[model samples]
Target: MPATENVHVWGDARPLYTYTRYIQNHFGERVQKLAVDAGLSCPHRTQGRLAGGCTYCNNNAFNPSYCTPSKTIRQQLQEGITFHANRYRRANRYLAYFQAYTNTYAGVDKLRALFEEALQCDGVSGIIIATRPDCLPESVVNYLSELAQRTYLFVELGAESSHDITLERIRRGHNARSTEEAVHVLRSAGIPLGLHLIWGLPDETPEMMLQTLHWAAGLDIQTLKFHQLQILRGADLAEAWQHTPEAFQLFGLDDYLEFLVPIVEHLRPDVAIERICAEAPPKYLLAPNWGLIRNDEILRRFEKMLLARNTWQGRCWRGEF
Candidate 1:
């Protein structure tokens, strides 16, 4: 009678492969991700693919002050561990997250050195490499497969939007085909895959946003994360919104909740949702002000909304529907 019966990892409340439960199930204890900047630069920024990186990007908006590339990997990991220990006391283990720019755009030898360094750090159980879809050359994919056998590793690709038009407008510099190819290559290499997508980009309607989930549900990826577009200071997106304003439709907290609830039903149950919302520092944020609510509070609100409607994840999954 209870939906939790059908779920193994995080129970009915989560409705998807929660990062917390997944780490616990695999490691026998909770593990937190310590994001490290690794001082990596993207081809888009340096090689003139687009010029100024993704239109929505400003690495400082998300990176903690301690996560500077100037510091050695060992130093960054030690500081991140301390920060998390004070904030999330439940986690005794960590996954070194290479989150800045295109982590894999560099040569395979450089990537290997950086990743191996993280793996050797204290309390780090594994590593998560966040990269662009266009950067995963065959050599990198092959190397990642080898690394997976030696240590726990996951590669997260930024597939941002499913629509090529939207990707172009946002200066993603890579198309949907490249994303699909990256997934196929990673799947073949036997590497665990994760995807990062953004909702509410300019010109994307609510219907179009839901379609991204439909697109993702068909993928073989093991984890997924979603964030609403945040027009942070110094971003080209913010400048564009400031000039046109009418061209974009940013979602306020309540509007986003209404939009997100039904979208969850359409996701593949096996795909874990890492995050549904993200917060930027108040000084940098420009619009759709949601006040100072933390991620946990927002998640709590989402759970309450689901129960009130009696809906669940994968309710409208392809075969089930």
Candidate 2:
């Protein structure tokens, strides 16, 4: 079974349904829509570092088939809605999740125009813009904040980790402070915010992960996604893995669960936990493959273990359970 957030389903513990709940709460309706990719490349990829994207980022890994750069915005929206609506016939609404590369790297006027265009689509309810923290401009921030006052808006930044060193090691280009400042600016403007976090980055110790979680809890972030760092083919991480495979310790299924439970508990209960793991294709995954067990399968095992051990989200955090 795939893990669901319904406490009744989990029986003893609560699994969270993140973005779904947040959107419903924000718009006061069920948000059973598809995330449409508006193909965009960040300036960081061209105007600067020119490095071959982030080490782990291959937008190809996540974008759905319905999302094609060649498709018109309307055509893409139609395709996405068709697929999702067929599966969930009852839902008639959607949020245009601009989720390919960096959705916020463009000029402010362009972002405003694209978002406005998305809203013009029939049945569309809101916008969810995903981008790198360093790439979100102040002008864009101001514009989005203003829009949120009248419409539902969320900005999910790839603040992958809290440590500067790990960011540099991953060729993330930006530092911890950039993420902190991004959240501060957006929150100050009254825009709802979401963040991306990777739990097992190379060279980051378990102690550091706990500290990072604590730091994350202290932020004004409203939502966060938890992901295990996965090494992808053709990524900078592939090269690192080839050279120092022994130096890296990939998490076995149970070990990763143990690693995450504490961080989850340490996290503020109010911050909606979006995703527990990054579900990559089997062909692309390198190791620790549990043969495609559903997310709920993992969650069931996790909750059983956590409870058997008399632990919850924050057990043994800061040397206190």
TM of each candidate vs. truth = 0.95, 0.87
Worst window of 10 by summed lDDT in candidate 1: 1-10
lDDT per residue for candidate 1 within 1-321, as digits (tens), equals 225555532453554456666676678877888899998878888987678989999888889878998899999999998887787684767899999888998789999999989988988889999999899888888899999998898999999989999999999999988989999999888888889999899899998888887887788888888988999998988889899988788998888988988788787766777888888888888876889899889978987887688776677776431
Candidate 2 residue pairs in backbone clash = 2-296, 3-295, 3-296, 5-15, 265-313, 265-314, 316-321
Go through the candidates in order and give each one's C-alpha lDDT.
0.84, 0.75
Runs with alpha carbons beyond 4 Å of true place in candidate 2: 1-19, 86-90, 300-321
Q: Give a tens-digit lDDT track for model 2, residues 207-246.
A: 9888788877778888887778887776678777879888
Each model's number of backbone clashes?
A: 0, 7
Worst 10 residues of 2 by lDDT: 1-10
